[model samples]
Target: MQGVPEEWTEEDGGTGERSRGTGTGKGEETMMMELTRLVQKTVKESSWWERRGIDCSILAAAFISLPPAFLLLGSSHFLWFSAGVLLMGVAHGIITIKGTHLASHGALSESQAWAKFWAVFFIEICGSFSALAGVKGHIKMHHAHTNVIGLGDSSVWKVPFLSRSIYLFIAPLAVPVITPLVALGRKYFPVERDNRTVAMVTLGLYSQYWLLINVSGFTSPLSALLCMLVCRAMFSVPYIHVNIFQHIGLPMFSPTRRPKRIYQMTHGVLNLPRNPLLDWMFGHSLINCHVEHHLFPFLSDNMCLKVKPVVSKYLTEKQLPYQEDGYLSRLQLFFNRYQELMVFAPPITELVGVQ
Candidate 1:
């Protein structure tokens, strides 16, 4: 109730009575239009550093970490091996989460050819997911229907049969393994067949296996496989949790009765406070500036962070919602209320009357 609108109540099915004083009238619409213009202007005026310079640096760092990681993993010493595996996992997470995310959104490049190339390289080669599927699922569906029930609501992550403990702690360890299998399954199952998705998914998985055996000096296939599993699961818990924490449990909307873009994004999306590791690994767009990213999906992570203050202030001054919650608090919320948040269909936030 702390963050809920004054008129909202569960008894009313989240459709609070319309009040002209609550800033959901024509004045609110005008303000939202102005806010959009302001954000667009901010994006256009963003410096090269905000556009792609920082992303390039992050990508470079992720790539640079790899050789050393392989070297360390290949070492005969146990401590050396452990350290190398840790570095390898961190590098992989950064590349997949940050690099792939940006590339998927076409935020990393202005050139169409380069964007496609990066998408293949980051999502397929590094992330071990199909670039085509990633785009179709994330960009086309998720972004277009954020918080809309049964579509972009991140409901796929929910597993009702599993206990909360296992869902939270154990199940996520399988994501790296499950990701490729799902991609391969998609290829055969054929919603829309693309030879490239299967090809790249296979190539990516095989490449990593080859690297583990050759460059990482694993003596046996079993050893190499073990190393792969361990490294991939390093950040798996938070990797899965972050996806759900930011979107699920927030106000959901009926697809047919969704609010205006500004209201939907502002009310439904929650931003976690920035963490140094998460910021670097997941990118600002996924971590701290999620609301801004949802509002303008094309902006780079650096640009999202740059525009956060302006976005937050504008929403605040206009008395619109600007949701921000701490990471640990969200985690606890999910852990404590997993059944309500993860297992059930969240009640629709009825904004039709208000809007």
Candidate 2:
């Protein structure tokens, strides 16, 4: 209720009639339309062929590369085996984060049925997270209401008991292990028409386990499990880190004083410098093109990158805040202000006089 928009409220007149024009509704509309045009121009430049190719290639790499890496475990060469496992883990992370993210937004396919199929396959099956839940929680809640406390604040990862070092550095390692358990645990809560999805995801995870232990001819079950965990850890750490860094330290607002679309996105989203490691796995949208991604959530990673200059320049010319900070700086900020920013709720500043 605190985060509800002011425009939705009506002032009670003497006759008990409601007034609807209290907020900067017209100004917000204008800003939204201007940003929408920029997004449309970017969309016109995007090619479906390129998007499909990138999606297919990433999916293929995730599925195709891992089997050979698992086979390498039988070699018993420590260095070679470790290298293979690392590669497998990075690839799996890409599938889980990038692939699942795209599918969750329905960006991977033109057809609704095909999009649903892919979202279920990549998110629930490969990523070991529920697709339906992700769309409702992530796309609908997080994206729609970024930096709004109790909605898009991303406080789920906050562990008050753990010190900054442990919470930031060590706890993330458990994300790969924790994710599937959380997914299964969600079944106890009410979700509509989700029984089949839960079953499929459970079966899919079991199928992967069976592949490693029985079919892949790993030295032992332990080896198979180790391989899976290693790969998932490669993804889980940065996945948690990026999620926090992108929006946590920036401006937050109550629903009544929430900024217009462009202002909210630019003010709230902070882009990290491009890192080769993260860029390749998480894709551009998760990396330096984050502001662009927040502006156009449906855009492919490549498209997000392509439109960066235009969006950044427009915001800069307009004298709006377009935040960019180095990855290390953000980590340090979080470390220094962990209590203020992470453990407790971030303070909300009511945006005033923005048209």
Candidate 3:
């Protein structure tokens, strides 16, 4: 509370905390500036490993896990093959999910050139998605507009025509197949075509196919293809769920009447408690420390974890909302409310004072 803006402090006529829906312009600016300073100071004091080295280790381990997985997949034993497939799927998930996420946000490096390099490597070569589209949609649109109804409220993930069970359970399994096709179709692109994006995506798809047949020792190309699809979609259910559960049912705002960044993010974003598998697959930034990630997009996953206590405590002391929910709880909420939350768009929450 030491950094709480004087205008909104208990001494002033105003309440110690701004309501979730509104903040005075000056108070909002002052509050964010103070919080920004605190975050910066905390980040600056942290070591290099906390900021970047741990992610490097995580990426390296995921890569290391692949060779054994391939060996197991090639085995004559059914149990060994099954174990191998599971291992391979988990490794692939970690690399693509955690790698693409960190690289997309430039959390791996300070240099724009290195950032773009990693973005292409992880997103295009590993994830088989266009790096340009990923950055444009995620950083520019999603992060910038957050819970603004038409822009960043995870609307794109919804399919009104599909029943809840189909959408949640069956549909996501095709994500591995659909992701590149959607990118190629220019569904999310701003231009008519991007040759580099198309080429890299094609290369990634072929690389996976080649690996499945060759290293995984599948004699039949058709069998290899099936193996590829199954491994790739191992975590698709949670992947789809995480995308929506974090933002969709939260407080949504009208695009034209957005609140300050702090209020918008705190009210709109909800963090799921950590699970060991999810933590490894999606990085801490995407999981338990989502609010911190949205607030400090550049922070590495380790850095985000380090700052979680600071962020949660600061918000609490200021009487600002700090949204956190259980993973199972959110899953149940979505399951029960699918029709209301996904099939039809929810109304926007009108802030008390803005515009």
Candidate 4:
């Protein structure tokens, strides 16, 4: 943990995701409130098409994975298969980072079991993570303590002197490789049920990978393993980078800190509206509609994009934060704030008020 601070409280309970009327930004007054309302209005009025777009992306991600799987079945060309797997793997990474991550937070829907299963399928089955263990660490630990050292996933494998700009690019490539080791290492050393799942899932994934490649006659057993490892390594780079963009470089608060939910979210996290074509392909899960996703996880990526403005308006009327930095601006911030941004910090422990 980086460091715990004081705490905040409103009439309802303590610091939480919801607003209870009383808050610290009471001083920013009217203008901020108007912005919040505007944002919310925009979110509310979002069109059906936008929502559909998100869904398309999700399906597209899955679609992209199929060809490579098919390729391994027929061809033994390691390079060709590696390239295809690398692409689809990236798709899985996007869905996991975006869809599964939100779903795990119960942000998707109330169907706890469905969310749980989706989380496992996306992260463990595809993106290479243990669903339960990832949640325990992500929802319970990381989200609970955004940038607190040793808590947040963002901070987990950061290395000093690694440039923030490059780090974002590098992390995706690292995740498929590093995250698994971390999961397996923890299980190997101390042992945890989720960790055991890690063992099981890893075995399953590799077995499937090997069986597919070999049965496909794409390569000899030796060659298939080599190709799989290479694809995973190449794929990890961008997957990690995309994950980093979703949340990092925003104002972090201790448990005591009372930043408006809107501000905390907008500034706290990022929205990279990049690769419109790819966004059409995998952008939904790559940080697009992020604010809406956080606000309403289950609202298909399509729904979130449409309602983003409406939500923004409501948040605006409430005089909350509504940040949407340009892609370049965010990239710069990551470069400037990588270390602190990646590390997790503990919540503040202060007065309990209607913050």
Candidate 5:
């Protein structure tokens, strides 16, 4: 495969290579280089505190809030218990979406050992998914080959036979129940497995159940189980929606025609409207800062947001695609054109003309 630029081939850094280009030639390279310089400048200007503080606060929130929420579940008042469940659900979502995501990318800590430790903790223990599997499926596959069929495609959620209503509405509610089963099944496949990750995940999940039953004062095992399911469901719906929304309707590519980094990400990824709630819970990589995240996958979410203006402006000035759509607009597109957008294979575009 040809390099994006001679100096910065994916093979040189193990970042993964683009298999093809859009044929825009030197002009494309010039635009990409300018964007790269801007990103480097932004990185240098960023403070150490800015780089690390948001992640620390997010981690603290996930750890500190869960125990109190669990204790509140023991309250006799219905309102109190309900409040506890809501808080617990929100905290767990942050752990899964933001905390585990950062750790999986090794963005949470500089040390590989510490990064792996927290990745396992947040993903397996709190998120009820396999850390090793996530690193393989998400980081290795999805990020390396975004929107490429049989690789980065988000086809897990695609169900062709289901009626649009059921597929869009009712199916998302089951994501919480389905995610762990999928994770477990992936473990049995020929993919890489970490014995420590499996053991830790097993222990963490069971311990959580035990705490919910005994310490949380749940009246019965069934009640504890129900609480767990409900809390996970709160995150699952939006999680499923966001995963599909960001890339499903965008341009896809055959592996042979995968464009260079900037072209591939800008063409394939999208940014949704700003939502303060999701920004905090899901982090910038998965929200309005998505394009920036793709361009700088290793940057922490805080840094991604900080550099967004430079990235966005450069893309716009160059007249390259910088896709953004409202959350509802995406939903409407998904509903109205479910077949073309989700069920059927996405159409791949070749950039044929240039300045």
Candidate 6:
């Protein structure tokens, strides 16, 4: 709510979604039309990056595997291995953030068939996620419906009194443990195919990984489990944090309502500032760039980054909202104030302007 802009209001007629309010003045405010053209132009120029083959770079996995590979040596080096464990965490997280997202959108789909195979392998085998399942859940269900109650994938909405604090922050840390249950919940309770596949693949990956670690004659069973627990926990924490900030703390409309494309995107999705480290590692998947990814999903990570400025500028000139923040600051805010940010009703008044 803090980063929420005044120019944004919810349209209440059909499908309610947070939208931008047009000001009467001309000058800078008139740039919305120009901004839209720039966005279109930049995206058109970003085609080359999408065709490039980064996903096929198998060496990325081998290189990233180094830290985790060292831990499989089975030596009395827990202290040193601890650092490796964390690196493993960072490595795996980056792979998931970059690999799965790009692949899901078909941005890395140069080889089509091979790309799908590899992307599914990375998420299922490396990231311990089900490729096919999560893709649909995200691209189809979530992207199509941002912050729209049970429809949107925005993880920010929370239960009654707890707000987003406990649900978004603390609960997300438990995701490594909980997602399996989430998957299980879907399986038995009559959920979607993708949801069930996500669970099964998760179980399969971890089971195979543990067997492989054991076969290597690595540390005792206890140590191996500890390493895994830490690895999964570390990965889940940052990912969940990133997800919660993406589309929460905005507006949510009903089943039949919808917001203007730009306003819905501007208010539903947030930028979350820029971190050079994360930018280099995860690139366009990090912030409001994600919405653009959702929009022009065929663009590669590099191309997405290139077009990000154009999109951000489009939102700003339209007097639209674009939320961003330092990671540490947001983490602290999650612990302290995030809960209050969740679960707000649509604005009583409606705003104008639609195509």
Which stretch of 10 consecutive residues in model 4 shows the poorest summed lDDT? 1-10
Give me the runs in candidate 6 sitting further than 4 Å from their true place: 1-64, 71-73, 153-170, 184-216, 328-339, 343-355
Error of 4 at 58 (Å): 3.3
Model 2 lDDT tens row, 242-303: 99999998888775557666677788888999898788788888889988887777667777
**Alpha carbon lDDT at 163, candidate 5:** 85
Error of 3 at 66 (Å): 1.3
What does candidate 3's lDDT look like per residue over 32-120, in tens digits? 77777788788889898887999889999999998899889999999999999999899999989999998877777776667778888
The candidate that achieves the highest TM-score relative to the unseen native structure: 3
| Residue 29, candidate 2: C-alpha displacement in angstroms | 2.4
Collision pairs in model 2: 89-231
Q: Kindly indicate the candidate among 2 and 3 with the higher TM-score.
A: 3
Question: Candidate 1, overall lDDT?
Answer: 0.80
Q: List the candidate 4 regions with Cα displacement exceeding 4 Å.
A: 1-57, 60-69, 72-87, 94-99, 106-110, 145-153, 161-172, 187-192, 218-222, 233-235, 260-263, 277-286, 316-319, 336-355
Candidate 1: pairs in clash = none
4 or 6, greater by TM-score: 6
Q: Write the per-residue lDDT of candidate 4 for residues 1-355, one digit (tens) a residue.
A: 0011111111311112344223545543443465445545655576544534456456555656666665643644767655666664555445545555544444343345555555656556665666666665655554444433344436555565666655667545555556667656554223555665676668746865766555556446666655556555654554555556666555545544544444444445556664564454444534566665554334555555556657667666655556565666666676776665653342332223324
Go through the candidates in order and give each one's C-alpha lDDT.
0.80, 0.74, 0.82, 0.52, 0.77, 0.55
Give RMSD (Å) of candidate 5 vs. truth. 4.2
Predicted candidate 6 versus true structure: per-residue lDDT over 26-93, tens digit per residue: 43234434554665587566544343444335327635575455554344477665666666666655
Give the Cα error of residue 177 in candidate 4, in Å. 1.6
> Who wins the lDDT comparison?
3
What does the lDDT read for residue 333 in candidate 6? 64
The per-candidate count of clashes, in order, stands at 0, 1, 0, 73, 0, 5
Worst 10 residues of 6 by lDDT: 1-10
Q: What is the lDDT of candidate 4?
A: 0.52
Task: Provide C-alpha RMSD values for all models, in order.
Answer: 7.9, 6.6, 6.9, 7.3, 4.2, 8.0
